[model samples]
Target: MSQHIALLGSTGSIGTQVLDVVRHWPGRFTIAALGAGKNLERLAQQTGEFHPRCIAIQQESDLPALRELLNVHAPAFSGEILVGKAGLNAIAESSVSALVIVGLVGLAGLEPTLKALYAGKRVLTANKETFVTGGHLVQPYLDRVIPIDSEHAAIHQCLKNEPVKAVKHILLTASGGPFRTFSAADMQKVTLSQALKHPNWVMGHKITIDSATMMNKGLEVIEAHWLFGVSYDQIQVVVHPESMIHSGVEFVDGSILLQMGAPDMRGPIQYAMTYPERLPNPEPKVHLDFLSLSRLNLEPPDLERFPCIRLAYEAGRLGSGATAVLNGADEMAVQLFLEEQIDYCAIPKLLEAALNAHRQESTPSAPSLSDIHALDDWARRFVREQANPLTARSTG
Candidate 1:
């Protein structure tokens, strides 16, 4: 049975890899809809190739050109759909698709993800912000949420067939970014280019910076708590300089299960897209022989050096709007760091302030999608107003 897919953020790194997976297993999947943020050329090429029923672009200004391009080949193509409120609904509610891949980065991906889940579409998710900001809104609808991130995918695979209660702990591994060896005092002088140079992964600018500051691990910790019904304490972050061991699960019987592979996004992406069944693809193979699989090292994350990871665990424990604040604040902080509006070390300080300001709403009913949006907006504004250079201190 071919799975029909609605791929939101079709122009992104993860989104493009998803298309690669589909292309490899042509008979196994179909693209029902495609959406992207302002990358009209790539979006147009995807639309032409996939012949999806609907396509969405972020900017309304790009619509006219996209529509004309589409009309030249796909004559029935109307104006390019804008992916605001309605486009999100359209992709989720599209009758043709069985699964929606929500790969949009940052908090922007949250609403569309909820819409897809609530509309009964299985979601292959790569965006950490979706769960970080609004898991409460989407948890009730999680019968179909599949993880596409490698670490989460590893956990998912390890936990299969095992009772959730039988799991003793989850070990979420990190590559420790480019600055794994840098002391806390040295991080203050780090440049943007230095931070962007990730040691193990090729990712977008925002995520690369997040990984450098260990904020990516922080976000993953939040993602782990939601994906697995585990407490914050049950989830552990270990810095594995080599990215080979994606993640691990320790059972109650003291047996540890680990998933190891080359650091490739397609492995997990393909798994989520063609789930419950495996398909063959000629992507790069994980060769343990020539690669020298000699040693695998694990160390406790240096929370003093990487406060963002600590802040994430704190927010995870608090629940409520805490994750929303952490996610929203970090998003803005990362943007600021990238723009040189703030120094490299200030990212977590800003996130910490936002988390402190957040007041947990009482055993609140499942948050509405709009409620999450509002909190995200509030966090961004709060960080911008309160973040200061002096507060940015060395992690040590």
Candidate 2:
């Protein structure tokens, strides 16, 4: 029997790859529901192909256009159409599927993910921010949430059935982005195009930027802390430009286990979708071409250049609303940098200021969902305010 699943962010980089997986194993998966943000054309194409029982859009304003597109493209789709956050939450809570794939970006993914877990649905998620911002809420439901990110998924594969005590530490690999070889002076002048040109993998703009700053790896470190029951110190980041060895685990006995494959998100997405069971992949599979490859390099990350990683470690250790603030600040900072409002170098500065401000404020040590959301909002505002002066100086 095919497993039924609901996919949020159905038109994204992860979502499209997931669809590719579904196409590969036609009878293995079913799309019960689909959700996306501002990409009605692609969403409609997916709906036409998959014919999910329900569909969701990010804004109410996109509803009419979506319906028209559905009419032209997926005229046979008689399913329900839901709008905004409420619609997303409804899909997460509904019984349309037993598994929910969260491809939604940023903080928008947190509530729906929480809702799905609470409603007893297993969640296969690629959204690192969900864990970075609200890992506390999701931690109790760890049994049901499977990570779909390549790094965490690689660790998940490596650590399967291995005793926690046998482990020494887990290593999360980083591609080191486009600026890995760049000097400190070179980093200050990097343009948006340069930052988005990732060396190994092709991803969405937001994540691509995060990768350039090494903040994606930083966020993954926080997620790994929550996904696997490990301390911040137990997780190490090695700059692996090849991206072939997704991640690894070292045992106390000096043995190491690593998961290696082509730099493809589909491999992890498929693993998460059909876990505990390995199935035959579609044509043009993802695997290492060691015969054609040469050497893999590993180096320590430069903290002086990419301070986001250092900031993430500090926030994860602080343990309160700090991680939430860290994620929120980075999201806004990345956006400002993408929009040319701030220099690439200013991303870390904005994040540090937000974390500092959050520490000084009186906040709950054990924050509720509301508290996390509030802190996220506060951090965004803090980053914007901090970036304004920089924007002014740049314009001047």
Candidate 3:
């Protein structure tokens, strides 16, 4: 029987690629539901193609606009159209599908993921922030929430049903962004365009910028900690420019297992979508000749250059609301940098200030999903208000 899937963030980078995977294997899977942000044009197009049983939009006010678009593009899609969190939960908890993919970016992904877990659905997700902020809530269902990110997926494959104690440590590989070779002086004058130009992978703007600053790897480190039950110290980050050896695990026996593939998100997406099975890729297959010619390299990340990474380790070690604040701050900082409201270097400084302020909060309460959201909001505001001074520091 074909598996039914509920897809969140169906219009974004990973979402679109996931749709491609479904399109590739029409015999193995069917789209039961879909969710998107405000991209009604793309949503309408997807609805026209997949005709999901139900659809949800992030912006409720855009419902009329979406309805109009669907009338033209998907005149036949009479499935339910829900709005906001209510709609998100409706599809997340929908009984028609047992598999849910949560790709919604940032804090927006947390609630719906929790809803799906509550509904006992097997979730495969790219939303690192969901685990970054509310990992404890999702911890109870660790077996059900599989990772779709390449690094985590690679680690998942390497473990291969082995006990956690059997592992020595996991190495989370990074492309080191476009700024890997750049010095502090070079970063000081960096612009939005340079940061967005990732050396290898093409991704959404926020992630591309996060990659430039290595904050994406840091967030992945936190996610790996939750996903693999490893300490921050046990999970290592090695800068691999080739991105061929996606990631690896070194067991206590000294034998390392590495999952290698093309630098394509679709590979990992398909892996999570079809667990315990491999798909015959239609196009863009990895060429052994091309890979054989490329030389792989690894190096330690420079803390002096990428302070966001340092903040991530500190936040993760702090063990409560700190990681949540760190994620929220980076999300807002990346937006500010993208808009040119702050220099590329100020991204780290802005994150530092937000983390500092969050530490001084009148009371650091116990971990709660709601508190994580509140901390996320507070961190965004804190960073925005402090942007001017940090930008001054960057240009000074």
* Decreasing lDDT order of the candidates: 2, 3, 1
lDDT of 3: 0.87
Best by lDDT: 2
Colliding residue pairs in candidate 3: none
Please give the ranking of all candidate structures by TM-score, highest first, separated by commas. Answer: 2, 3, 1
Query: Candidate 3 residues 1-396, lDDT tens each?
Result: 999999999999999999999998877889999999889999999999997999999887898899999999999999999999888988999997999998899988989899899999999999998888888778899989889999999999999898888888899999999989887898888888888899988888888999999999989988988898888888888889988888999998999999888788888998888888877654556443553654778888888898888888888887658888888888988888888888888888888888887777753534787788788888887787788656645644
Off by over 4 Å in 3: 288-291, 362-366, 388-396
How many clashes in each structure?
0, 0, 0
Which stretch of 10 consecutive residues in model 2 shows the poorest summed lDDT?
279-288
Top TM-score model: 2
lDDT for each residue of candidate 2 in 205-312, tens digit (9 for 90 to 100): 999999999999999999999998889989999999999999999988999999998888888988898898887655465667888778889999999999999999
Q: Give TM-scores for every candidate, taking all chains together and pairing residue i with residue i.
A: 0.92, 0.97, 0.95
lDDT string for model 1 (138-241, tens) is: 77776689899899999999998687799889999999989889988898899999998998889888889999999999999988888888888899898999
**Model 2 alpha-carbon drift over 4 Å, by segment:** 283-286, 389-396
